[model samples]
Target: MEWIKLIGILIILVGFIFKFDTIAVVIIAAFTTALVSGISITEFFTLLGEAFVKNRIVTIFLLTLPMIGISERFGLRQQAVILIEKMKGLTTGRFITLYALIRQLAGLFGIRLSAQPQFVRPIVNPMAQAAANARYGKISEADEEIIKAKSAANENFANFFAQNTFAASAGVLLISGTLTSLGYEVQATSIVLVALIIAGISFVLIAIDNFLFDLKMDRKYGKKSSKGGQKS
Candidate 1:
């Protein structure tokens, strides 16, 4: 009977292995776990409601999506493309590296943003594509997708590694709390210093990656068209 309480884990594993609907699989696992744990259906719903209420702030990101959608509908992406096309001597790699640096700076300042929907998809990705198009005349579909992926990767790399540079950031606070609970004294400032070092390394690595990306693109595609012979 006790072993039956672990059924939820088995269910979740099977669902993931078989590629079932993710949300449904998770919900089913929760319900099954609650039932086996002797939680009544009413009690289960109550617990779910309580958990949702406690974590409702996590859903705040959803509110930004509609605003982003409205702006995109009104040619936000097109404006970004135009802006990038107008910039002389800005190559795709240089632009992406610059954006990653900006992302890290924003994180250091505790300026949280929905990078993918708000920045990358609407601004960065299109701008990178425009920079490529400006230099190459017209890039292949595959090349455009590669640029999109690199844009997203830059956002992720900078945001994840640099957030702790803010002494009051969640990662800094968590590290401090965990160390204190383990009978060790820790300072958020110390955590931030380490985070800064990690962030610097990440910036260097991303810059190198961008340089390699530019070289690869140059090799795969021909030199910049004579009309727009700008070095990346």
Candidate 2:
């Protein structure tokens, strides 16, 4: 019966596999685990409350979403498009590459951002589309989708690789603590240095990818525009 406590893991796995409501599944798993472990319902709620209180800071970031929504209602995306239009010579790929660099810098400084909602969807995607329009006149829906995907990818890659570059970042602290618990002497500073190096490498690789994408877009769109003009 003691092994029944492990049934919570099975419940969670099955729930996720079957696409159950995520919060309900997690709570059900926790309740079952507590019950099988001989913990009373009152005690379980007490533990849950304690854990929530201790980690409540994690939810603070969600507050920014409402503000972002309000801004979008006030023409935030349109303003981004207007701004991008005036920036001559800034191509879609180049703008996305620049955003990646900015995101990396923000991560290295421990500044948290909700990339997809706060920047990518509202700012980056529109600006990228505008830049493409400026250069190639108008782009296909497929190319717009490509810009959105690449913008989100840039944010993900920069944030994931560069966040640990901050000495006090969650990743650095978690790594150092785990290594120390495993009897290894690991310093957060050391992890930060390694993360910075990885960030630099990722930035270079992403830049190269953007350059290639620019070349592909040029071949597909730029030459077509020129040829159409010549025939006119």
Candidate 3:
């Protein structure tokens, strides 16, 4: 029945509204569509296998997860703190702002290596704290949490707004593919181009906010000497 064609969408709406398991909802949606379209069971599985092989890139992040975990366990984060402590004139806000810029730039090329779970919390957040200590001499727990929270927000805003600019990015590809299949005939480049304004504005606004916060910190602690302190 033509009415059955709407079942996939209905399942999605209800599944999300009820907060059901997302993966199971997607599987059910696909089955509902196949069944309504009179697809034989054998053909449905064959098509599913072909689709999986075509887009196995979705599993690439899982391959890198274990190595990231191992690196953290072996003192990779401690090394980051030591390196950051050695850099003179790098304040808490300056370090976080620079990180956001680097992450945003990498997003243009579809690189997301500095994400929060694997990199920022373990590595970047600690580095920011080291820089703060170098500048302020000592910071309270509350102030440290403030810096870390800002660092996390910086990474999230920069990465979330900028990554869509990469035409070949997985998110962009998925969106464009969905639209194309629905007969919209849109190009990924157009989407990326439109997103550029949003990304650029976000980078500039967040950078300014960060540097201004550093000015506030400078007043809280005595301003640094012109020598930028001894290197290492």
**In candidate 2, which residue pairs clash?**
none
Clashing pairs in 3: none
Compare the candidates by lDDT and give the number of the best one.
1
Candidate 1 lDDT tens digits, 1-232 = 7999999999999999999999899889999999999999999999999999999999888898998999999999999999998987788999999999999999999998889988998889999999888767778898888899999999999999999999988889999999999999999999999999999999999999999988787776656755656444
TM-scores for every candidate against the unseen true structure: 0.79, 0.78, 0.66
Residue 37 CA displacement from its true place in model 2, Å: 5.0
Query: Can you list the residue pairs that collide in candidate 1?
Result: none
Better of 1 and 3 by lDDT: 1
Q: Which stretches of candidate 2 lie over 4 Å from their true place?
A: 1-18, 32-40, 173-191, 223-232
Per-residue CA lDDT of model 2 for 1-232, tens digit only, reads 6888999999999999999999999999999999999999999999999999999999887887998899999999899999998887888889999999999999988998878888898889899999888777767999888988998998899888988889998888999999999999999999998998999999999999999999888878773243334111
Query: Lowest lDDT 10-mer window, candidate 1?
Result: 223-232
At residue 71, candidate 1 shows an lDDT of 94
What RMSD does model 3 have?
A: 6.5
Q: RMSD to native for every prediction?
A: 3.4, 3.7, 6.5
Model 1 spans > 4 angstroms off: 33-38, 65-67, 180-184, 208-232
